[model samples]
Target: MEKIVISESNYQIRKARIVRTKKLTPLETLFEIVLDGDRSLDHEPGQFIMVSLFGIGEAPISVASSPTMRDSFEICVRAVGRVTKALHALDAGDEIGIRGPYGKGFPIRIFEGNDLLIVAGGLGIAPLRSLIQYVLDNRRDFGKAHLLLGCKTPQDILFADELDQWRRRMDVQSEYIVDRAEQDWTGPVGLITTLIPGVHLEPERTFGVVVGPPVMYKFVIKELLAKNIPEHQIILSFERHMKCGMGKCGRCQIQNIYTCQDGPVFRYSAVKHMSEAF
Candidate 1:
């Protein structure tokens, strides 16, 4: 076992295809990546993998594809930093290093047979997309599932083709809002929180999962708590500047919790009180 571990430290990267790529917005790009080898990514929903650009840098990216798809995985990348900028430059059939399917994912077992209220804002939907696709794939494991997605503008939407498919599905009740709308936009317009009140849910049976920017959490969480969802049942995924995907790096530490190891995913009650966790 130790010999296997030592040999893999060189971080062998498989040559994968871009397979598909979409220019969601001027600043964001979504890449559908697949491994060239026979092995699948084998990731849980909400779990993130570190995408390495070799000489440039490594960035922690959530697996945006569902575990259902045997052929490939997806990652929605926002060109906000150096590593991401490098990632955005590449396209189909590109070679990039990959290290982990690290951090804990959503608690799929606990959510079994329970209603789910999934809330995603801005780039936050990048991570939640994995879990949503999973739940939709295995719809039997969960009860009524609702997705609430919000972005800066109509053009900012990620996974547009998938979003339309979700909107058309009878099994999944999905809605989206843009903070600001253009003349052509016809969907709901407002902060994501505005759409929360309209979503009727049994607070006791429903698990509220929210993933969004730092500012979005403070307000959205307050809405979920007010809806009577238990603090522990309200789940969230946090973001930070990460270096090493392992906990050894202090870059992603939030108080005593390491975002890379202890989470990127956390229950609200466990971390709501922590400063800078927003």
Candidate 2:
């Protein structure tokens, strides 16, 4: 019988070193990493990579930086579980294993020349940050851009400094809200959906990109639909718990579709029929 040899590249783990670390919040820490030989992650906005530690297991983390930043890439980790807690404990100069920048990412070409309505809730901003940064870098390629951000509290907001920079940009329209207000918080107090109603855009030329918790989708999508945006123009990211980045694991399967391979980013019209997608 002939021997069938499998390629190791599919499961190859590259060694990467952390160059910097920033404590975004008490629970979330951001790591700036560079691969061996200064290799760029070269990932698209909304794509994720599997981060591994020797003794501890690996977890899938979305690429938080846009591909425009060629020097290095970033991943924002929240200390929620065993692997993430361990990841949070590491500091700059630490070494880790990196497998891939897997899954489908946001389609930038299709969104070109169209106004963008980007909505992020809580930790969902991590992935959407990639797309936002890309748009900012290539601002001339797109039309009007709007950012609607929601966090639990003032302390829970990630990238505070960058968020302020975004708000200051005359080219971008940015609005924020918090579920509960702290003494220092002077912004609107309510759900993210509340900001959607006041946004002014041409539905035919607007594209709505949303990333957030499962519960946020139902309400947010409803609001987007009410804005008269076409179903095909509404895009979403479903960050499911994918055990293996490849399609073989079946961990991120939504019915027959693999969220890890087929999605994590999907159009509203494409997955609207799938009850589990939202």
Candidate 3:
């Protein structure tokens, strides 16, 4: 249980070991990481960390696990680029560099007494999974919770086993849809928006949280707004190229706001008009 001590600099990296790994899909992998010294990554549900792999450079990855799970954190990665490509080559017991649980996360405190509608599309479920787990783990603190998930195909859905568990839970309600269905799949087939209308929720008491691709947000937000949910009650997490988790890089700027500093998660009312936000 060696403690991982970081230097005074905000950019200083902490050593983390991959305790376990699971190949979630052909391109995506889930890594359960334990920071040195068995430290807890006390991060809000939607915050992200900068992951470094020696000379390959670093990239921002969200904390996929809930903060309620104190021992270790999880991050889901897609092998799409240089840093992530290098990341995918590693396995359990591999040590890597980590910094931050940076950015403002989901407004769980504000949502404590409200019903929640979680909408996730494609790989967007990565970060939303944390919020979903947090709400479920603290079910008594919140009202009804509904998760509406959409992905490209049956094989592309993220957390199949865990989703099954969520579906069976009496405390949570979940519906999954895929763009293209497979022979073995029996669930609904359509856009994620289709499922939103059928959800029984009191707009005044419900908060809608959405995360997904740029295109997905357009339609999903439209549906959420149409459902009579207020603008400020709808939360959105934008997936940006957050090169530096510290917000100095300016790469993740949405107009005057730095997504790494001010957001990654923001109320839809605050960013809806910002062209670059969605």
* Candidate 1 lDDT by residue in tens digits, 167-258: 99999999999999879998889999998888889999999999988899999999998899999999999888888766776999888888
List candidate 2 segments past 4 Å from native.
Answer: 1-10
Q: What is candidate 3's TM-score against the reference?
A: 0.95
Clashing residue pairs found in predicted model 3: none
In terms of lDDT, which candidate is strongest? 2
Residue 235 miss distance in model 2 (angstroms): 0.5
Give stretches of model 3 more than 4 Å off: 1-9
Instruction: Kindly report which residue stretches of model 1 are placed more than 4 angstroms away from their true locations once superposed.
Output: 1-17
**What's the count of clashing pairs in each model shown?**
0, 0, 0
Q: Estimate each model's TM-score.
A: 0.93, 0.96, 0.95
Q: lDDT tens string, model 2, 44-105? A: 99989999998899999999999999989999999999899988888999999998888788
Q: What is the full ranking by TM-score, best candidate first?
A: 2, 3, 1
**Alpha-carbon RMSD to native, per candidate:** 3.2, 3.7, 4.1
Instruction: Please state the error at residue 194 of candidate 1 in Å.
Output: 0.9
> What local lDDT score does residue 201 receive in model 1, on the 0 to 100 scale?
93
RMSD of 1: 3.2
